[model samples]
Target: MSLVWGFLALLYVSTDGLEPVPVALLAAFFTIFGAGMNVRLERSLERKGEYRPSRKTLALAILAGAGFLAVLFTGVIPALSRPIIGSFYLGIAVAWATRLILLWRWEAKTKRRIYVEGTWVGSFYLVPPGPLQPAPA
Candidate 1:
């Protein structure tokens, strides 16, 4: 999902060329969707005592989003002409597919562990732990 959104973002960068506002909007949508999916996956993992992203990882994601916006606004990527939007989408699709395949393979190779605790009131409150732990009590 992250890779898919990133591919779309790259396509936007390389194609008919979204204006800053549209690009920013797309970025926000992708970021929110990606974060939501991460939350869902983390919850699923918690049920099995398996993988979750750390605070450092979330912080890095925030930093990366900021940097991506800065680079876009700074014109680090050249403006794309309208003639090649199809090719841009094609390229992005290929890149996204390849990335997804690779990530699937990598994940298959390594097992990850996750631990989560929650307090229930009117609403559920999730509390994720730090990266390291002594042991499960």
Candidate 2:
């Protein structure tokens, strides 16, 4: 999901000639989309005592949102060109890429086996397989 978002963001930032306001709006939408999916995944993990993003992670998200809010409300971005806004989208793409790597590494280290309903971000668990019970596909 993050990879998809990152790719789309990069494509938009690099190829599109959208104004700063539209770029920022797209950024906001993508942020919400990814964050909501992440939150849903995290809550599922929390319910199963499997995982939770740390306070520092939450703080970083908050700070990023604040930065976007500043740009949205302050009218500073309107003066800037697409390159600047593109840079912001690029930053978001980078962040999502970093998050993907981290989540992959974390999953490897934790030895967790997640089972999702529809997608990787869907509700999942870490239950161990036992006798007479095959592992999830």
Candidate 3:
């Protein structure tokens, strides 16, 4: 993750030496790919009855991060020329906070479900239902 952001930073700095839109497009593509992978992984785990972040939560995080960046770019926060330079860090913080809150909520829900189900193993593991068996003669 750091590496991707680092590469984006490098691209932004080198934009004057190259075409900016193309570089920006590539960065956007990579970001989308990473986000899609995260969503797919979360859903897959959720289907197994494991605790995972919800898609809505993930979307919220993305929106927050994007909003932070948009604010910085539009000069709403007035970071001066530093807006372009500092936007990535600010965006990262926003996204991290979003993800953390999402995970917390997901864990809380999982705990509640476990309690309601009366499971002995707590919330970490999910067991599928099976038919009862009779003793052999």
Per-candidate TM vs. native? 0.33, 0.41, 0.31
TM-score of 3: 0.31
Would you give me the overall lDDT of model 2?
0.57
TM-score-superior candidate, 1 or 2: 2
lDDT of each residue in 23-135, candidate 3, tens digit only: 45554655555455445544654777554455676677578757855865576653334434454553343443454455456555554221112122113334333354222
Candidates in order have lDDT scores of: 0.46, 0.57, 0.47
Find the candidate with the highest TM-score and give its number: 2
Give model 1's TM-score versus the native structure.
0.33
Pick the winner on TM-score between candidates 1 and 3. 1
> In model 1, what is the error at residue 60, expressed in angstroms?
0.6
| Residue 40 local lDDT, model 3 | 54
Evaluate candidate 3 by giving its C-alpha RMSD to the native, one decimal. 13.8
The collision pairs in model 3 are: none
lDDT of 2 at 46: 51
Better of 2 and 3 by lDDT: 2
Sort every candidate by lDDT, greatest first. Answer: 2, 3, 1
